[model samples]
Target: MDNTLSRREFLRRAGMLAASGAAAPMAFNLSLMSEAAAATAPSDYKALVCVFFSGGNDHQNTMVPYDLKNYQAYATIRQSIATPRDKLLPLPGLLADGRQMALAPQLAGLASLFGQGRLAVVANMGPLVQPTTKAQYLSRSVALPPKLFSHNDQQSFWMSSMAEGASSGWGGRIGDLFLAGNSNAALSCISVGGIGLYLSGKQASSFTVGVTGNPQLLWGSTNLFSPSYINELKVLMSTNKTNYLENEYVKVTQRGLNTSVQLDAALKAAPALSTSFPAGNSLADSLKMVAKLISTRAQLGNNRQVFMVQLGGFDMHDSLLAKHPPQLKMVNDALMAFDSAMIELGLQDQVTTFTGSEFGRTLSSNGDGSDHGWGSHHFVMGGAVAGGKIYGRVPEPIIGGADDVGQGRYIPDLSVEQLAWPLAKWFGVPDSDRYLVLPTLARFDADALQIMR
Candidate 1:
């Protein structure tokens, strides 16, 4: 082992290798000891669900500014592609803290959640090394995420506090800490979007399930094989296997098999909901599986859980005006159905769902499309949320200005670490142990925490 490679450096290298399709097995070897051994854990039951927009999401339309002044600015920026304000659904009342704004018509499903105090918007958030001002950003004195505006890097940074070049994800780090308590050691974190570095913790990695609901075994239906062959397969995977590589491979396969068994059992035990998810849709189906899993938390013996579901096609580099609406509608309907399922199961207050993306789009349109930029807006929904209000600073729509880097790559007022740390803390992590999950949070001076009940 190279003693000189810092944890951050090691993590970056690991992420790079993993992203390039390397099959490096992650083995979290940290102590199973609880955070600080003396800090208080969450007394209430809670779970965090991350709805990841796989590609860059255009925040310009999702959280629209209906107010006259901001609307004018926004209309000027978006021009022909802007979602008309008349279509925006006005908020029912002043948000909990009195700041209220309407959302695009496509987001009416989430609008209803807002009226019910079940959704909140966190504005202009992205990855940052520290509190970077325009001067520092221009002068290149402040440490910034490497390769800003690149999809791969920003996505990596969003999922793991470490930049796209990082190795260990913050979520994986958190999973490692709680892996010992998970009933299904085969899976502590679950992803509908397949294998990701964020869920690749040292000891606990994400168990992936397809939205199509098929986790087929690598070796299935071997009726032609003799009884001896079946016996050999079983014996090869036994706990006492002596061959190192073969044993490791068998263990990996067995873990996947165990996860499938446990997950299927849990889903079968869950009560069917009256709410119908949209037919033949990936996002809707993913949410349905999440609902089923949450219903069987007791059987799975997980007091805290995190799930990731992704939907792509937000990178509207061209033809955005025509292509954006349908994608937004899909997200809206999927979220609506997911929330309703939670209500039916009476787990509304127990689970919180939030949106994340690589970054935001540029204010100025690139002919028929929007270019990749920084500092995108995000939303959170759950029965426990302080809905109808927007958190963080919404940037002014100015191109090539102080906040806007040329075509509106706005400096984010809130870092993703700042946004996610509180949720992790709420899910039973101690104050002292927060560093273990989000170490880069310290670099950004993102010390302020707590976002929900």
Candidate 2:
């Protein structure tokens, strides 16, 4: 076997040879491939992991207020399903005003990080047209996300940054501009919890990794064939490149195989960690796999990358009191584990993790559950995060007031563009490239938001 015949090199040559026919003479040029790889490689080394809550995560429940009046307001609106204020785990840290708030009791795992200044809350963040106020919302003078109450519409709006029916997601848009800087052809934007519209890049689509920290192979048992079978299949894939679809399939499969080989090799070289993630938890397991991948970042030679994972069952349409705590617990625990793992790998500064959801549920309860509403709060956690405080103006718990869009559908105080722009800039996207990654971002001159460094 020729030392130079890497699986990728062979596939590349074989594809070319098949395209031009064996009789037609063409050199097996490796320099062309090298040049192409060099053209796409980036110099920076940063990664972003986005954990999207499929349904609306209840912000009030996640980040609780222990202030007497606010707690009374919350309990009054919640009626039968309100979490007891006494049961809420009080955070020890003093805010700027020396007032104390409690973390959701379930989020006990993350309290320490908050104390360590590695966790922060971005308040009242959602898709926005501009710095529209509650007056603008009630007057209908500004454009708002369409069908804001509908789950499908809101979800799409959240991911795509369009009113409701946008085709592509902002994450995908970021990948589109950033993929030109990636040396690896193994999908710069990947989703571990499965395919999502959010991770779909314009030119580079998302590749999926399984929960067990492996790239899934679609060609099951056939991929396990002996050496002779492998030779036969390779010949078939090479010689019979008549059908365009088949050839494309062959190309993708070969690429996937090569990628898997490299990833597996990298994973094996990663040092094992002593930290233990709780068993049977989806968020914990998914993040454990991410930690494994991040540990291999040096070998993958990727400077910038994006990952999407999700946790579902956040709709909380019923049994809000009984069901919502565990979800928050899972989120808190998983993030704590992930943050610890990043520290273990000395990647605490290099990686930033954040959360987003469809929207926040209403402040007034529907007896047992909550309904979908407009503006919601989100979380950002990393060594780089400026923790211990809220960023956006906190919404008044007053129902049917200026902020509330009837029944507590609060108009957003801060736009998602404002919330995400700083991170995009921090990711090493040049000033000229910001608008390309975030179209809505151009609306706001982010000359003031200090989300990074």
Q: Please identify model 1 stretches exceeding 4 Å from their true place.
A: 1-45, 92-100, 212-214, 217-232, 239-242, 445-450
Task: Give the Å shift of residue 244 in candidate 2.
Answer: 5.1
Q: Which candidate gets the maximum TM-score versus the true structure?
A: 1
Q: What is the lDDT of residue 98 in candidate 1?
A: 45
State the lDDT of candidate 1 residue by residue for 292-358, as single tens digits. Answer: 7777777877766678888888999888878888888889999999998888977888888999888
User: Which RMSD values do the candidates have, in order?
Assistant: 5.4, 8.0
lDDT of 1: 0.71
Off by over 4 Å in 2: 1-44, 91-100, 163-167, 215-235, 243-249, 445-448
Candidate 1 local Cα displacement, residue 145, angstroms: 0.5
147-169 per-residue lDDT for model 2 (tens digits): 76777887777777765545467
